[model samples]
Target: MTANENNTNGYLVGTTLERMLKAGHFAVTGELGSPQSAHGEEIRAKAALLKGYADGVNLTDNQTAIVRISSIAAGAILVQEGLEPIIQMTCRDRNRLAIQADLLGAYALGMRNLLCLTGDHQIFGNHPTAKHVFDIDSIQLVQMVADMRDKKVFQCGDEFKGIEPRFFVGAASAPLADPLDFRPYRLAKKINAGANFIQTQLVYDVPAFAKFMEKVREMGLHEKTSILVGVGPLKSAGMARYMKNNVPGIDVPDEIIDRMTAAGKGEPWFGKKNAEMTKEEKRARSKARREEGIQVCIDLIKELREIEGVAGVHIMAIEWEKAVKPIVEGAGLYPRPSV
Candidate 1:
């Protein structure tokens, strides 16, 4: 079906992320944090809840280099539940054959949107003891997928059927973490390497993001590929601090932190405590932080959407799926895209 008819039908058409990237207005998407364990019931329930509010849900594959269910497997489950699943495939845990086989399997199951990544090191995740796999990095992964879809055959001689996947493929980049002047160059390289779209790591500096977009425009990439800026609601000053200091490739500016600090301080709306807390107590104080975060995120999305070349926002609430609906609704985006 045509994209227009899919839009009129109230469901995203063509393919999941393909249609989303093609939306005229900025598209809004979200991720599903993998379950701590492979509890089918819990995973299923989260799928049901997030299905309504997000364009599609991204399933991480052993995210942060920790061991868990593979993203392709979890994606199959999400597809079975009638939710568009953007499978997050990383090269850290699999070789070319494993990755190719899984891609074919996902296509067979009707799951197509894929966010390819180099993945995190084994030392960073819950299972620090696990062995690492780095046979192919993300750019290589993108090229591999391009080869499969465009060529219709793997290096192993496995032939794929049906239309070439036409998978709406994306890769992760860190404009905020890299040297500011060099980000566009890096982005250009990735685009040339076969990245169809880019999902940037958490962005806190809107002006910096604007500059990055400008640089990308100068490279002429803005017109050729879709760019989705990643936004995570800062739950508190402490969490904001953590993002600034700990999250690699994510730069949280002092001004934004100050704004978050001032926005919810001592202002109890809806009868909730709103006191400033120290870093040690941020987790305990998250209730108030979350309230503040959602509002901040809604405002941020509004601002980010206004940037010249930004195609969309990727809202990642981490384990906060319940908050996604309210934030999106508060941001004036309801009846979320179903492509």
Candidate 2:
């Protein structure tokens, strides 16, 4: 389908990310953190950094429960900036009525992609005392969005008077997450609920991820929805180790940690801790770790590309937008394909 093509029939998702996946282009997507204020320029500045590096940029919805600019509004800003934004919606705060209302507004603003999420609890955000309103879960949200687009009706079964939003709906996955044996089944549930694509949590252990993909292939979930493996540059050896030890479902390998530690070794003030380093030394040290992180991410993408059931890579450098370009280019996914 042409980029500008619009059809009421829903056969064509028509978003750049959808087109790339359809044409087997090995899509690249990135995360753009909406700032914690009503700043359109912040979104634009980040768009400039990511414009040519990704097929679609995801504008997170009050990520981490922190209040921020709405993801849909950020998506509109991105559209104005000549970049495609994937508006993210979470079930943590809104009811069905609010969710549908925002989606209608998002489509009117030229947003074409959506990622349904069960957002972080209010305890994780600034509003610890706020009430939780998970009127629906992520799976139900996907089904609702798909229904609005394809079935042309709201979750209440009310028909759209003129037009319903056409979104390439997506759902998140944590392949290595516990009840480890049930992850694939969970993915299947999302697909059965009408997710057009899947974006996963950050992946560090390629072999473990590949095993998860093996089950995905067996279940044929990959054929039903595009799977974008998540990747990101490690900021430091400590970060890598921390994730491996603390982050649930994230299994960071020893070799990667060793490599991250090695990347910082032999640098200026090698023996000095980051806290004790001079400002200039800290800068140099950070630059080295970031470079190594980018390389490691690139290598992961290459390995993932060769694996079955993997359609793309989702680069999640939320606060570190500058890393997106180098990571994409190094992975040979830059100069994003035109739909």
Candidate 3:
């Protein structure tokens, strides 16, 4: 079906992310983190850097539960800048009322894509004393949004007078997370919940992710929804090890660490023997490792695109915006679709 049949907005009817995916394009999306300060210019500046490289940019919703500008406002700004935005919404801070209200506002702001997340707990954020209100989970949120678009009613079954918001709903996935066997089933549930697309958590273990995809294919979930594998640059051996050890739902293999370490060998602060090296030396090594990381990401994207049921790659160069262009170009996904 064409995008127009699924949306009412004139500006977003047939030329947004929804259409791109429906047309079977190899879509590329990037994540944009809002600055802590309320400077709109910074947000625009960062988005400008990704203008041509990414098909759409994900405006994080207080990512990690840290307070920042609203994803709705950021998405509006991105729309004004001639960029498509995937406004992210989480259930950590808002109740059902607030979530529905913001969904309406986001659609009014010309946003065509929405990503529903359950969000990290408040304890993980800077404010440990804050309370959370997860009135609904991500799956429910996806269903609610879909209902608003398709059924023309709210979760309470209240009908609207005018136009209902038309959104291409999306959700998150962690293929390598614990209870690996259940991950594909969870994906099926999300699809049943109205998730049209899914972007997975960062993947560093290729074989494990491949196994997960095998299950995904086995269930034929990929035929129902588009799957975008998440890939990012590692920066350094220190960073790779930190994600593997500290980050939840992330699995980084030792070989990647070894590659990063080996890439930084020419630097004076290559190994533990140089632990006492000056800050400048360490920075130099980190820079070298980042280059290697970019190449690694490029290779991963190439491999992921070859896999069955994989629609595209989501390059999340978190805080490393400048690296996105190179990574996309290197992966040969540049000159992105005009739509």
Candidate 4:
């Protein structure tokens, strides 16, 4: 269908992200990490930085289980600044009651997009001693939120008195997660459970993701939902190696590592032994590798846009928020659509 035709159908025409995506615009969403302190200025600054470049900015919910300003508060801050915020809700820190209440509060705060997550374990954060409250997993959380929005009722089938939260529900997906063959089916379950859209884990190995998408297309899951493939800039060869070796469900091909290594060779410290290189020299090498990583992301986005079922690109420049504008422009996705 044509872009204009898709726009007129109007499944979700409220939030900028929903409008842009529904209008068949190649949508771009960026991630913003909430500060550990309740400094409202910091959140506003990040939101301002992403203003024109991204259709929406995802406010992480104590991402990695580390304590931070609440996603709902940060989202409210962004909304006040005229930026669209995707409030991420993780089940690691809250039970069903808190989750439902937060959803209601977020909607009242004018936040329209919700990204439900199953969150990292407490053991993975600074407060390992803290107890977890995984009363439900991500799938169940998505289902619950969908129920609240569509049925105007609680999980126990209790109806609401007045208004129900209107949210454009989203969920996370790790396409390269273990038992690769099952990843597609897992995604189908999320769709069945009521995910309106999906943002996947960072993707570096394109061919592997293509294979996964093939399975998804075979099942016609793509037609049932919108898929935003995750793309991010790698800082260095060392960082790439670290992610591949330590991070779960992330696949960084050997070629990308080699490319970063080759890019770093352009630095003055190329032939110098690691112990002999000065800190300045080391920093230059890291910068060169990061620049190369950005270029790689630009190319990846161009490639992903060609995939049949791929709906959009979620440019998660991680801590490098400034790089998003350049990457999006480089990939020719700039001049974001106006909703």
Candidate 5:
């Protein structure tokens, strides 16, 4: 009579990373950016490529309000490929009934992890013509999931004849958003709403993040919740600039920009130029970037982990999936768990 017995085949419910957080270990997770169109082959190829390197793949649901293949479809593909799938549930495109149906479908298909998001505005993405349904924000979505689990019923008023879902519920956070002082309050709200863990927007200011973690500890949330500091690899100077100037809800300090600028000016270490360098040079710089990224990553992870109540790390490499294993290894995380 375990709480998880209701889950589909007792597969690890909740995100693999969240399960790890609950178990008291630093966990690693990644995202699988869906293809722009119905290109299933391309999507499957991408997920297959990331299988061994990531503990779970978060299939974005119209991420940034961008219209793309559905997250459920992508989640199904990831599950079939032997990788854990985190079904990214956004309230932008569906009403409560649709949400319930989708969640049930995902569980039946073997998806366990759920990352609920409030979703981006439609105007920000390519699909301006699409209608949005933010009928429920992320907090309510978390509550809804909890209710379904505890009640063994769907929002659609249907009773389940079989197992209930044991979802490792997760929610998003942007530590740098709005008045800095208000972040802790927002986090408290999400936690109150049943968010088991959080994955933050890409963070650049380690000291600022450290301060935030301190506040989390003071609030006594450090041990009660798991916080994963998101990290995006800078593919080049331009990519770095784009993230700073264009990406919403991310703050990259002038110092980090200065470092990348300085690095850009230095001679290509190992006689490499741009992306066309020999495989060995490419490997070396990739290693060096991952090392550099991991150094910053480890610093934050160490500080974040030391926070009296903080649990594990979730490393997000974006399109640089190849670098994830190295970065995690570089950060000294061995035997990366499959779940």
Candidate 6:
């Protein structure tokens, strides 16, 4: 049995998220990027925006290699704020012992969900010179955490000194990543390693994503783990194009980019005349684009919901937590299920 299925009386790790999914509610999860300072109030303020909107709030661990409030600390703050916090643990910075200690403390602090990530390489972060500690890859991290919860043993194969940490283990997936044909098999490894749920990279091309899910369903991975497709607002046309052209594993269709472009160009011209618009007009266009992005995300959620293997949607309104309520309600996923 996986960590999620080893509770005292029955299955379920006793987390709100695990129970929600087990009960078959189309789950909704949101991301909360911890600020770069140690301001507890900032974490509380963001949690306020996410509290009722998401079944679980993910606290990113030093996302983009930039130093921020640690996910564990922020997760504790979230627990105090009365929200379910998903602690994102990355192998990029910590060794196995450090990870185990953090997990123990995280569980003691009332965080029951964990997301295992290899993390963005340090090269992309502000501290490029900082060394990395890929002591174990993400898949192994999942196995290790699962072992602790289910077998009640440490990664060292020793019996737990006391009650073991029982986490609703989660991992990430990128359906559109390179070597596309291998993505399904790679996902199987995670499932086999004991991922209770998966949060995938943001996807804009529904048909392409559906194709990937078709393969996943063929393998019956969906039945083994809850799959939550990632969806997010584009913010601006530039943001859409940047992810499409530059970001790996993200497949933003030209139609999405075109729609974002249209949102910005509410006027009739796409030429030099557009450049002559005043700053006020520019600001108005940006606002319109953000609204359109939200609508697009809502529509995508609706579409993804119909796909057979999709258990729910993970709305990543990065730095735009305020938009989550509207997007969730827009997609008819509001009144967040109370499991």
**Model 1 lDDT per residue over 1-339, tens place:** 653211224322256556767766567778887776777666677787787777778888888876777777788888888888888999888899888878878877778688989888889888788777888988888888877766666756566554445466778878866576777887777787777778889888788888778778888988877888898887777788887888877778887787667753664342244465455455444666677788888888888888877887788887777778887888887876544
Q: List the residue pairs that clash in candidate 1.
A: 12-339, 16-339, 177-249
- Give the TM-score of each candidate: 0.86, 0.96, 0.93, 0.94, 0.84, 0.95
Q: Measured by TM-score, how close is model 3 to the native structure?
A: 0.93
Off by over 4 Å in 5: 1-15, 156-161, 264-308, 337-339
Q: List the residue pairs that clash in candidate 2.
A: none
**Model 4: what TM-score?**
0.94
The residue-level lDDT of candidate 3 at 76 comes to: 89
Q: 133-248 in candidate 3: lDDT tens per residue?
A: 99999999999998998788899999877777878889999988878788999999999998888999998888888888998999999999889999999888888999999987
TM-score, model 1 to reference: 0.86
- Choose 5 or 6, whichever is better by TM-score: 6
Q: Which stretches of candidate 2 lie over 4 Å from their true place?
A: 1-11, 274-276
Error at 100, model 1, angstroms:
0.5
Total backbone collisions for each predicted model? 3, 0, 0, 0, 5, 0
For 169-261, candidate 6 gives per-residue lDDT tens digits of: 999999999999999998999999999999999989999999999999999999999999999998977898899889999878888888887
- For residues 1-339, write the lDDT of model 5, one tens digit per residue: 674455334423555665566566677777778888998887777776676666678888988887788999988888878888878999888989899888988988988788999988898899888888889988889888866776677766576677777677788888877788989888888888877778888887677777887888789775666787777655544556778788766767776565544442354664455566877766666555545554555555555555455455666665556666666666666677644
Model 4, range 1-339, lDDT digits (tens) per residue?
A: 642221324455277787887778888999998888979999888887899999889999988888999999999999999988999999999999999998889988889899989999888888999989999999999999899877878888999876778788899999999988889999999999999889999999898899899999999999888899999998888889999999999979999898887886655688688799898998887778778999989988998888889999998876688788889889998888777
What is the per-residue lDDT of model 2 for residues 3-29, given as tens digits with 9 covering 90 to 100? 543573435568888888988999999
Worst 10 residues of 1 by lDDT: 4-13
* CA RMSD of all predictions: 5.0, 2.4, 2.9, 4.3, 4.1, 2.9
> Compared to the true structure, candidate 5 yields what TM-score?
0.84
What is candidate 3's local distance difference test score? 0.87
List the candidate 1 regions with Cα displacement exceeding 4 Å: 1-13, 156-166, 267-285, 337-339
